[model samples]
Target: MPKLTTPISDEEIRSLKAGDTVYLNGIIVTGRDAAHKFMIEHFIKKPVQPDEQELYDDLKELLDGGVIYHCGPVVKTHDDGSYSFVAAGPTTSIREEVYQADVIRHFNLKGVIGKGGMGGNTLKACAEQPAVYLHAIGGAASYIAQSVKEVLGVYKLEFGVPEAMWVIRVEDFPVVVTMDSHGTSLHDTIQAQSKEVLVGLIS
Candidate 1:
């Protein structure tokens, strides 16, 4: 399997095709619903406010040529004020479809990790921005958390743990390319094929 590490380039991202199994190694940030909306409204749709500027800079540095995981991890805080992921399962990605394309474009993201899949807008962003949608296994929260090697930091704890953006370093993190930069989406393909089978059965 191809191993994707930090500083991943657009060429590297575009080289991946749907159904390819890959291992990711590097810094990734986890973001869910609240994080996404906050990013869009506070960072994308409007100019960054003075209070939010630091966060915007941090996220911009991390996300450019980096990956974002659609995860709301169960975390364990150490007595020393550190954190670790107990369960890092991916959340459903479709909920962020409206904001995802913009995020990818604005952040220069190379990949998106989540369970299930996204929609046309995300697919278009993948093609145009030269990014990919990586599918992490669902119901394997504990197993997935094992790949999280370290918790670098976090943002927006006010949104609560689940919705907060958790910065982490991962090693050999496994995922499948369900949506590639070439406009191929396994989710769309499967749905179309399933529809064909259903029509055949009913006819």
Candidate 2:
């Protein structure tokens, strides 16, 4: 199992092949539908507004050679204004397909974590941007939360806890490289195989 740390280089990302089991040890941001849309609109499609500059700068730095998780985690807020993960399962990734390719290219992201793999645009971005899409196990929220070592900060709490962009530090965060920079997509392979089997049965 390859273990990768944050600020992973494009070279490091390219070394990974589809079906590789990997563990991540560093910072990752949680972003779901609202967060993805907001990022595209505020940071990618248009000029960064004055008030959004800080968050934009922070995200730019963090996402540079970094990873984003398609997750809406359950979290607990402490009295000291800190937070912790209660459940950290990955959400379906396809919903972000509209914006994910651009996000990867714009932010220089090396990896994306989620379940239910993404579409062709994301696969192309992964190949062009030298990024990979990692698949986390679904229905294992509580189990996955155990890998979340700390909550560093969050943005857009107004989007609600799940849709908020939560910065988290993780250790031994397990995932599989379902899509690779070399243009291999496990999801596509599976779908093709399934379709062939269905056609064979019907014929």
Model 2, backbone clash pairs (residues 3+ apart or across chains), number: 0
Off by over 4 Å in 2: none
lDDT of 1 by residue, 74-187 (tens): 999999999999999899999999999999999999999998999999999999999999999997899889999999999999999999999999999999999999999999
| C-alpha RMSD of each candidate structure in angstroms | 0.7, 0.8
Candidate 1 segments whose C-alpha is farther than 4 A from its true place: none
Candidate 2, lDDT over the whole model:
0.94
User: Global lDDT for candidate 1?
Assistant: 0.96
Query: CA lDDT of each candidate?
Result: 0.96, 0.94
Alpha carbon RMSD to native, model 1: 0.7
User: Where is model 2 poorest over a 10-residue stretch in terms of lDDT?
Assistant: 1-10
**Per-candidate TM-score against the hidden true structure:** 0.98, 0.98
lDDT top scorer: 1
